[model samples]
Target: MKQILQSLSSGITEIVEIPCPSVKSGHLLICTRSSLVSAGTERMLVEFAQANLLDKARQQPERVRLVLDKMRTDGVIPTLEAVQSKLDQPLPMGYANAGVVLDVGAGVEEFSVGDRIISNGSHAEVVCVPKNLCAKIPDPVTDEAAAFTVLGAIALQGIRLAQPTLGETFVVTGLGLIGLITVQLLQAQGCRVLGIDFDPKKLDLARKFGAQTVDLSRDEDPISAAASLSQGRGIDGVLITAATKSNEPVHQAAQMCRKRGRIVLVGVVGLELSRADFYEKELSFQVSCSYGPGRYDPAYEAEGQDYPLGFVRWTAQRNFEAVLDMLATGRLDVAPLISHRFPLEQAPAAYQLLNSSEPYLGIILEYPDPQQPNDLLNPTIQLEQEHTQTKAFPSESHTKAPIPHQPVLGFIGAGNYATRILIPAFKQTNATLKAVATTGGISGVYAGRKFGFGLATTDPDSLLNDPEINTLVIATRHDSHADYVCKALNAGKYVFVEKPLAIAPDQLDAIQSTYTSILNSGTSPLLMVGFNRRFAPQIQKIKALLANLKEAKAMIMTVNAGAIPPNHWTQDAAIGGGRIIGEACHFIDLLRFLADSPIVSVQTTSLGGVELREDKVSFTLSFADGSLGTVHYLANGHKSFPKERLEIFCAGRILQLDNFRKLKGYGFSGFNSMNLWRQDKGNTACAAAFINAIESGQAAPIPFEEFVEVTRVSFEIAEAARH
Candidate 1:
């Protein structure tokens, strides 16, 4: 499959070949027939990508602040690596597309194979999209017209906000594709419409769509022109659809509206308002989000859930259906809006044509043979010829095989986590680095070059297929951990995977089934999870100190683990296993280490639903030794506040560890002594132990049974909380 991507560093566009993505449950596999290149939206993306480092910094001061804050918390080296990795990633483009279904995933009852669908699937040849993000296309709608579904949804949403009544006067600012579409929809609602834009060509198109068009470039005073057209009463409402960095468009909308008029913004614009204009007219100002009600709601978008039509009349998907409804009848026309078309193979040229102001509107990328189209976009793609030349390390055959005395190491998923934490730590170890594989092109290439790996590939299976690579380190997303681990184990290679062995219980069972066969073999592969907190010097010292206490009856542990936003893909139950399964596992594992006993029961409570507030979760773990541990996972805390604070009560003594940096012990006399700990030493120790265990052919780093038990407890707590 081939996909289009834009390089942020260079602003260059390229179409690269990559492995076709497999369909997942509740997902639709679509072979794209046509995709619309939203000129206003895509042009802004291109310009932002092309900006220099200083210019980019000036444009996004908040992002600059975040980078500086991360440096303070995570230190300099890790922050720098994160920034580099982000820069190296190529961002995918396009959202509105018309395609035919190649196959449907499990539990997708909406469409069947060979059905035409309109979706926000990008400009890819093949796209595996969640079912909710797609809608069925009627037989009457052409591929080009069907591709406008998402854009029409945007326009429909804006119109829905204005709620223009019959005979009401409406003005649409910025006559782009969305602006023109809004003008037509408002006209269909029996509202008198006026359109404003600097582009004479787009103004002409708006006029054809039943709007009274005013060319801002030619008219010195658009406010007067609009008023004169409205017979001096002023328009009832105004929709600003222009994309600009200046707040002038918003100011125009305010000036051109009557008293108590509504001003809805459907495009990206600066919202620095002039208080007098709004105060005098008492106008209502609103920014209509992408599409409508359910656009950014994860449950509605990814989980195939829907809001009742009676209560929520117009959702993002419903907005899409409304657009198709308009097209099905003669109420709305979009065919006249399209100005240019290019085949999928000419995608690079299409971007160039769109970038250059060569008199075009609604440029569409067409696929002649709908059976086979490019599908991979964004995070996945093939390396360009130039990228292929930048060797991360010598090819497999070029590098000599590892000697018997040396431990050969192969890695999968060289993402920021691997580069910043694992690779740097491994550099300090005695293990011989052989290869690193990553789906993203630049990270694998850059890390392989910097760390002197023997090979770099976009495919993890290639690493598994290599004969000389004896060990595998998996740092990919949580959903992929089980399958990758099973493959490595079957290949007779030792395995080390990151936490939360798998996202679901069934996945864990599959991994455990493979474990038995490996154990039956004489040399069972060592399976280790990256639970580095167990190796922290302070934690080790605490365990030793607690071991000597004779009268200790119970222990309480408080973890101030911070919150993650609900929109983050990690919060999605399918992908990241939610916060409890994804992150709470670390705290649970740490508790297991401290208690030195298996957790018998777990209970959880939270203040709000999973989507609203993610920070306020409390968990209690019961150990067989009659000990109890409490974890306070609060999302609302100052960044400057210490992240992790642990307190222990045992044998009439209280011990506290503050942020893993300082520790204090209080004795019976009320005397206290404090100690500061060194950073990086714990991480270094953990990495060294992992490498040594692989080299010596010893037992797993942590007991495999204990690791599985901790995972089970973590999932159980989350499942209980969700119910």
Candidate 2:
């Protein structure tokens, strides 16, 4: 499928060929007919992308602070690389989409195939949108008109917050698409409206929608206009829908609003407020979220959970429906609002219009009709490289006949961790990069082209069934690890999965059973969990130092795992397996490796609170060799603090590793200190070990039994922490 992508590094907008996304459960696969380009929002994105690095840093001071912190801990080169990698990613554009349901995944009962709908899907020929983000279009509404539904929802949501009443006077401080829509919607509710904008064309459109106008380009004062239009009485409410850095709109909105009146911001503006403008009036100010209530909620949008109609009254999807109803009844007219249209292939020109001085409002991109099938509708496409630079090492081939054990690689995910760490690590090895797969398709294509992968696919099955690929790297979500592991094992291929082999006990049992069956059939391929910290240079030094120790050792691993949002996927128990299993397992495995003993017993202590925060807990592992280790995996720490610290005490000697970059020895001869210019968590070494094992037909780098033991111990620690 050819979809529009904008490069953040170069500010280049183009349509690129990528595999079409497959429909997942609770989602609808829509073949797009039209997608509206949000001028105000998209213009900001394009301008930001086009900005120089220093200007970009000036625009986003918070991200600049984060980069500086990363530099402090992870070193200069890695931090710079991280920032560059983030900028190199392609950003999908557009949200207001109109399409026909080409297919529906399981549990999606709201719309059927052939049903026309409006969604917040991006500018793509095919889009897989959650049911909560989609609403069926009425028969009377045209596809072009329905493409305005999501933007209309944004206006409606802002008005909903304003709580407009009959006979009320309202001022919309911007005559853009959303501003014009707000004008019409407020007029429909029997309210007198005043629209303000610098554009005369937009001001004329607002006047056509029965709104009194104040043209900013003419140096007209909106506050004075509101006073005159409302018969000397202050306006009942003000909706600031203008996009500017000047604080003038907000100050004007405050001055125009009546005492105890509402001011809802539905656009971006400087927020430097004059306290007296709002204090004396006791006015209410609220920044309206995009669309409505269920917009960014994972449960509502991703999991198909809807807000209760009676309690919430209006949700994002409900708002979409309301706007469509208004369009069907002619209460809301969008015909004059659309100023431009372009075919999907001409998306670059449309985006260029946003950056140009040419006036535009509600630019729509039209897609091919569903009846006319095209290659863009296909879920799979071959990625042909103009230059074939991918070379395979002449190592022995194992599973498939005539194919050497040269470790042909198929990566199942191209997420941040995979792209920044795992993929780069593997690219350094002797493995042949075969294909990369991702659910969304954009990142897969990006990673494929950037790393010289033979193919980019949305389907993992195709990669698994390929005869040439003999190794699978599962860097997908935690919930998918075990299933992919079993599948890869059954295919007689080596498996290297990221941490937390399984999220559930039953999943672990299934993986064990699958591996056992493979073992009994004499075709068991190696399975290795990504416990990379154990392979770190510092940790290896610690292991070598402890080799001759005879007494029991005491090891302490303090992880200043910084706080993420409670709603982050890693904190979700079902999806991310919580921090204990998702991340702290690395520490657990590292300690176990240094101790070189089985974890015979375990104990855990959590914070004393009503809400069980597994992220802030401590656990102790009693090893069979009498070596004891405690992992303090606490997220309640400052970001400026070093992230990870390890202290080991064995036989009158001590070793301390700080943030995987520096190590200090205490009371030890010939080894007082060791340090690195950059942080090294052994990611490269781990990848090399796995590849070398496959190439030489040797046992997995870290024993398979140890992988299972570490995973089981992590599960046990989680269970203990819960209580």
Candidate 3:
């Protein structure tokens, strides 16, 4: 399917054909009819993307600090590579969409095939949207008008927060798409409206929508204008919906609002508040989130968990229904709001206009008959001219397919981890780099060219279905690991996936059942999880020393993991599996490796109650060998401190590994300390081991049963912690 994406590094927008996402449970696959180009939000993104590197850094100081911290832990070279890889990724554009439902995923009951719907899906030919984010379009609304549903909801949410009543006067700053919509909605509530903006065209549209206009470009004093519009009394309330760096909109609204009046902001602007403006008047200020109550709650939006209508009267989807009702009843008019329309192919021209000084109110992108054939939507789309994998190093020139004895590797995800570590490690081995794939074409091509891949594509199944590729390396987000592993095994190829193996027991069960079937058929390929800590040089040395001991070992592992922002994908338990399954699995697997036995039992605890935070946690493991292990994984810690520390005691001897850089041994004669100049967490050795095993037709370095056991332990710990 064709999708539009914007390059944050270069500020370039392009349409690229990529794999269509499969409709997941509780989702609807919609073939887009029209989608709105948000003037205010998209303009902010485009301008931010067009800024210089230093300017971008200044815009996000927190990310800059993260980069500095990475440099101190990881080397400067790797940190630079990760930063470049991040910037090279293209971000998907647009949100408000109107489309016809092509198919409904399992567990969805709201809509079926051929139902027209309005959703917060991006600008694409096809979108797989969660049911909660989609609302059915009434027959009276046209596709172009329905495309404005999400924007109307944005405006309505702010109005809801302001809580205006009949005869109240509300000042709406910035007569852009959202501001104009706000004016009409306020008027519908029987409140007097005053609209403010610098553009005369928008001011005219506001007047058409029943709002008194305040043109700021004509040196109009908004404070006096607002007071006069309120009939010598200050405005009852104010809604600032302007996108600008200047805080004048906020300042003016605070100044013009009547004493003890409410102010709600639904736009992005500088918030340099003055004490007098708010304190003297006793004003109540609130910044409204996009759409409304259930916007970012994964449970509500993604998992189909709806709040009761009586308890929460206006959820995001409820706001959509309200806007549609108004449109159906002839109360809200959107025909006069749309300024321009472009087909999906010419959508680049629409984005170009966003950067220009043109007057655009509600620009819409319409989709016509899809040019792609039906077969292209299949799991695999093959391309001719596959790269020959056996080309020798340039110094030893030979162009031919690699010998069957060697492993031909095709990477499934060219993300930050793969770009910084896994790809670089594979460069040293004799394995063949056949292909690479990512969700976006730019990253796939960029990392492919940089890492010397035979081909690059935006489709995962294209790599999986290729006959020349014999081994698959999975490094995408956490949730998809098990599915990729199963596909590779079924395709008769070896698999190496980063941990944790599976986020849920059901996914693990599927993998186990598949592996068992393969085993019975004598077509099973090796499967390994990248629990690289067990492969560390110091760790192996510790294992060898422990083998000579006569007593069981007690271990303590402390991880100062530090914090990631709450909104990061890794924090989404449904996607990245949260911290326990995503990262703490390493410690769990490492302990199992040292004990050389299965984990017998698990227990866990956390610092927060019912808050569901994975940041601060402690868990204990009981190993079959009678050894006990405790891991204290704390995310709220000093970044400068060593990330990991482990201590082991057995047979009157103590051994400690500190951040994989130093191993200290005590209470043992003739045993000396070991150190490395740089930290080595065993990722390189782990990749090499997996490749060498495949080349030699040997058993996987980490046994498949151990992989399953470690994953179960991680799950148990997380479940116990949450309870």
lDDT of 1 at 50: 85
Clashing residue pairs, candidate 2?
Answer: 396-404, 396-405, 397-404, 397-405
Best by lDDT: 2
**Candidate with best TM-score:** 2
True-vs-predicted CA distance for residue 557, candidate 3, Å: 2.0
Q: Compared to the true structure, candidate 1 yields what TM-score?
A: 0.80
Candidate 2: tens digits of C-alpha lDDT, residues 444-466: 98888777787788999987887
Task: In model 3, state the lDDT of residue 472.
Answer: 89
lDDT of 1 at 553: 37
Question: Which portions of model 2 show Cα errors greater than 4 Å?
Answer: 370-375, 384-402, 610-612
Per-prediction TM-score: 0.80, 0.97, 0.85
Task: Report every candidate's CA lDDT.
Answer: 0.78, 0.90, 0.84
Q: Stretches of candidate 3 above 4 Å error?
A: 371-379, 382-405, 408-469, 474-492, 502-525, 537-555, 563-582, 594-629, 647-658, 661-679, 712-723
Whichever of 1 and 2 has more TM-score, that candidate is 2
Candidate 3 steric clashes? 0
Candidate 2 TM-score, true structure as reference: 0.97
Candidate 3 C-alpha lDDT tens digits along 156-257: 999999999999999999888889889999999999999999999889989988988888889888888888888887898999899888988888998888
